[model samples]
Target: MHRFKTLIIEDEPAIRKELEWMVTQKEELALTAVADSVAKALDLLAQTTPDLVLMDIQLEDGTAFDILHHHPSPAFRIIFITAYDHYAIRAIRYGALDYLLKPIDQQDFNGAIERLKKQEVAGLPGRLDIARQMAIPEKAVDMNAQICIAATDCLQMIRLADVMHLSGEGAYTKIFLQQGKRITASKPLKYYEELLPGENFIRPHQSYIVNRQYIDKYLKSGILVMRDQTEIPVATRRKEFIINCLTTLK
Candidate 1:
């Protein structure tokens, strides 16, 4: 029985503790070191080479990219962890690396571990380049914009325009699509709210962010009617703003 040495780099204490607990649960994984910042991560990397690194894309001092770039030829497998952003997902896919969105699910975690157990990593430079480009904070052109949505068995790509609405349940969000389908994503509603095109999407309620194009009508009862005929509540405070956004869209 071989145990893979693993390092976890995350800033949040609660998240770090949770990851530590999860790592302990896996008999095949051995937690070597945990660091909260890029500088500390570098020091740890210098001390011991881990077989796998569970890194947070965004760190306090610098990003996980900084650490990766520091090591020209990284021998370890990297599994990026982040809140919920499409750009990071795209980069991870491009790099042939695995990623787990925040509010990590046990199933997804197990799946990623299983993949690492079987797959041989290749194209390190290419993947790293894509990640670097993604971290630059530029909105991708609409036509080229693609979101990697995680499902039970695989990652699916969906167009931005096809997303009808998003509903939040604590840390997870359920994305409703125009094709009468829904996918549960392991990211918070706030994550998608910030990632989606602002001009077309609006946070009508704390639990819901609706696509303006899919909105059919706004009822006086502070409810929005979707093209799919789904009734989503509009926050009292955001009613005026929602109405205004709808008016502009019209």
Candidate 2:
């Protein structure tokens, strides 16, 4: 088995250590080098070409884009690690790049690794345009226009408007779409929560996130009925927030 040659670029010591340990845990991933600054990252990249790079967007001297700028067309794949910045996330989404929000979950990290493996096998193209768009975001791809779902067989891109809701299935997720199409993805629901536009989707329960556009009505029994007549239970704790979201939409 060929393990992925990986590089870690993070400034914070604690995060770097955490990520280092995490990388070590994955037998299929081999840690090639570690860099704490953009200059160090660039220097290391020049010396060797790793199959994958886990990069932090915020560096001491420069951002992850600085490293990307140094190598316009890089051979390796990139998975951006960023703090919660809505604008930056929008750019990443439009650029069609994968990202993990701060306070990273282990499962999410593993999911990203799995995604990188798929991208590598499929020779996924770089989304350097997303980094550029973060600076001058003009003519960005519409957020609600489409969504990419990782199916059992492959990555499937479908219209966001067609999705009715998402159901959590432990490590996987079941996406309910229009025309009664249901696809199972190899990632958790939290992954979609971060990827999807906030305005379009809302989590009514720990197990369910329903699209606002597909909401038929909120039943008195504390269930949300989707356009496809699927009854999604509303968590008692999330009921108020869900009501507010529904009210705001109206």
Candidate 3:
């Protein structure tokens, strides 16, 4: 098996140590270098060319984007590590880049590495550009904002405004859009509920999240009628809250 040369860039002492241990534990990965800040990462990048870079979003001096901006054309694949920046996480998802949340789980880390190994390096620069653009707070929640859906075969970037509703199917999410199109995303509905803007999207039930723009009417009998004539059940506990929300929208 070919071992990929890996570099870790993280500022937090505990996280950096944990990441280093994880990388070193993987037989298919070779720990080439580690950096605690953007400057140190840039310096390491100049000295060694790693096959994979596991980097955190925020560093001591600046963000990981700072390093990428300086090195316009990088040869390595990137897997972002973040604690919880809504815009940044959305940006990474929209760009179709892999990411691991802070206090990383070993299983998730391994899965990310395996997925990176299987993916091709084509179109990375363009994806990175999209990430960089969407990372901007103002642009992230705009009308033209999009979310990347990981389908079985391909990644689909769908405009937020185009999404009508999302249904949870165990571990997956079924996204309903205009023109009767549907996408089965690998992520769960809860993932989207948190990622989407709260002003436009609302969770009426544990298994369903609907876009306010697509709602046609809410019946007093605990049902929401969508523009496409789909009837979504409003949980009994959420009836009052949902009704108030719809009333407020009117």
Candidate 4:
């Protein structure tokens, strides 16, 4: 691995020193610059982009989010630092390798550093906008429980919500929406599980996917129900997790 260089963008001197100590302790990393404000960070970025940045969300001038908004990376990587567990900050952190919540846990810090070290910025897949990706299907993709389908051609666009269940058709997948609208997607069922909002869905089998809101009731007899009364067989082993997720809705 190449020697990783780091920039610490933090407002507090004590925290900055602590981060510098941590970085130097790791033989692979070199602490290059410390900026208490975004202006200084931006100036350094203009001169040279570092391998990684240990960035605090709130700065004297602006947020790390603001910095990220203006400058994206691979030329530079970010490890967010925040005192709060705000969801908006979390979403941004997800786009990067990791984050260090303030009073950073040593274990999490070590874990984050380890993750930053292993990353091949080029290999991590580029991001997909949540709205655009969700729009690939249609109607209630964001919230509202309406049936979702975007018909753009001669062929019908199947409503995702109408889906009774999803089943693996080999390595590919089939969407089993109501009124017998079964469509095939090149992606795997696991892909949809991650993309879909968890509250509205469930993974009952390695080969099958389910929508929890459509579930009528579950029976220990091993069958799950849908709005149309479609019966989906649940893999006994997957029942616990699926049951727990479904119970969260109630």
lDDT per residue as tens, model 2, 4-100: 8999999988888988899999988999999999999999998988988999988989988778888777788888888888667765764557888
- lDDT score at residue 176, model 4, on the 0-100 scale: 80
Top lDDT hit: 3
Error of 1 at 140 (Å): 6.4
- Winner of 3 and 4 under lDDT: 3
- Stretches of candidate 4 exceeding 4 Å from the true structure: 93-96, 123-125, 128-250
User: Model 2: runs farther than 4 Å from truth?
Assistant: 1-36, 39-48, 69-73, 79-123, 126-142, 236-238
Q: Which candidate is the best by TM-score?
A: 3
Better of 1 and 4 by lDDT: 1
lDDT of each: 0.81, 0.80, 0.88, 0.66
Which residue pairs in model 3 clash with each other? none
Q: Please give, for residues 50-161, the per-residue lDDT of candidate 3 as tens digits.
A: 9999999988799989999986667899999999898889788777899999999999999998899887677677678768877888753664666667776677878889
Answer with 1 or 3, whichever has the higher TM-score: 3
Provide TM-scores for the models.
0.56, 0.65, 0.88, 0.56
Candidate 2 global CA lDDT score? 0.80
TM-score-based ranking: 3, 2, 4, 1
Judged by whole-model lDDT over C-alpha atoms, candidate 4 comes out at 0.66
